[model samples]
Target chain A: DAGITQSPRYKITETGRQVTLMCHQTWSHSYMFWYRQDLGHGLRLIYYSAAADITDKGEVPDGYVVSRSKTENFPLTLESATRSQTSVYFCASRGTGRGTPTQYFGPGTRLLVL
Target chain B: AQTVTQSQPEMSVQEAETVTLSCTYDTSESDYYLFWYKQPPSRQMILVIRQEAYKQQNATENRFSVNFQKAAKSFSLKISDSQLGDAAMYFCAGAQGGSEKLVFGKGTKLTVNP
Candidate 1:
């Protein structure tokens, strides 16, 4: 697809296990972000990358790690998944510089930890 | 840190009618941008509209428009001629000019009655 896409649309994992969600965008947006959506809490930024090799943490970055080795790819990893980590993950991207800062999101990955 | 707040958790409107979803955001940044995102049951985050802090005119896209009050830090979305397809969860998000992170509200679930 030409837009952002996430792999493993749905996943089931056990506690203490590791899981990774992949995100890819063809827009070549300079900024890529990951967010988790939970009940009551709409969506919170998990991590963001300004560019390849440049990443930063967001409000809820604990227990989650992200790396952006390429501008088109930004993957999120949960080293040891917990029950509380069960949520829908979203990947978004936007162009940089002087332009519309509106971000476009992926279809989302639903993760369930048992 | 910038925070977005959505007071309405759920709203219902008859098809062909108009409905407004309210959103409030707090930010210390001088220049920022606010956005409205629609997430249907498919879990795809679709950009509905956007407003820049520096622009006095409210942004509109088709049936969707925003009443952005920059001074009050309030940004609300008005969906005119609400259709059954408009029945989805609406989220408000904000990002500063130089920041790559986006803060999203809890979201409001809108239901359209046909």
Candidate 2:
């Protein structure tokens, strides 16, 4: 079903440069989220959107921006990438069914900031 | 704010044995959700199982199951008949009612030995 997909599965960028990771889902889920996985730090939420135009800052939202212009696409942008920003980024989505909170995750984007 | 914790940094289980990965969380919300995700070397985050706070019965998917204790704020995953495919980093995550943002644990690296 290609439940969830991410673009540029791998990327390399220099410090102070801008980078964007793209996520798309086929389920048309009502919620979309961005997370970065790092050693010892686990996976930290970066940003999330409740719907097409409703976005909110997550625990690690600083230095990052997100926009959900469409229900299936949620893109995460790093204004100025830093060495600390080098991590595996994941995107996930969930349907709006009541009492159901299972999230479907994408393959993830591996970003390397030099 | 909620916090998830996985105290075990690594765990090992025999190919035909059972293993339990521990996870605990702190949250004031009475209605929240917990999830267990598996990430292999391929970096694909796969949902092994999930539990809803209101459900007393633990969730199970094939050989995977979860022990959900709402009062204790504990959600542990148990894998029976472990196979080589079971080797991966297992993550525990949580989210408040109706919230799309998730808090993740540091993860437990599982090794399935033959």
On TM-score, the leading prediction is 1
Model 2: runs farther than 4 Å from truth? none
Candidate 1 per-residue C-alpha lDDT over B59-88 given as tens digits, one digit per residue, 9 for 90 to 100: 999999999988898999999999999999
Instruction: Tally clashing residue pairs in candidate 1.
Output: 0
Give the TM-score between model 2's chain B and the true chain B: 0.98
For residues A1-114, could you state the per-residue lDDT of candidate 2 as single tens digits? Answer: 888999999999999999989999999899999989889999888898889999998888899999999999999999999999999999999888556678888999999999
- How displaced is residue A29 in candidate 2, in Å? 1.0
Native contacts recovered, each model: 0.83, 0.78
lDDT of each: 0.92, 0.91
lDDT of 1: 0.92
The DockQ scores of all candidates, in the order shown, are 0.81, 0.75
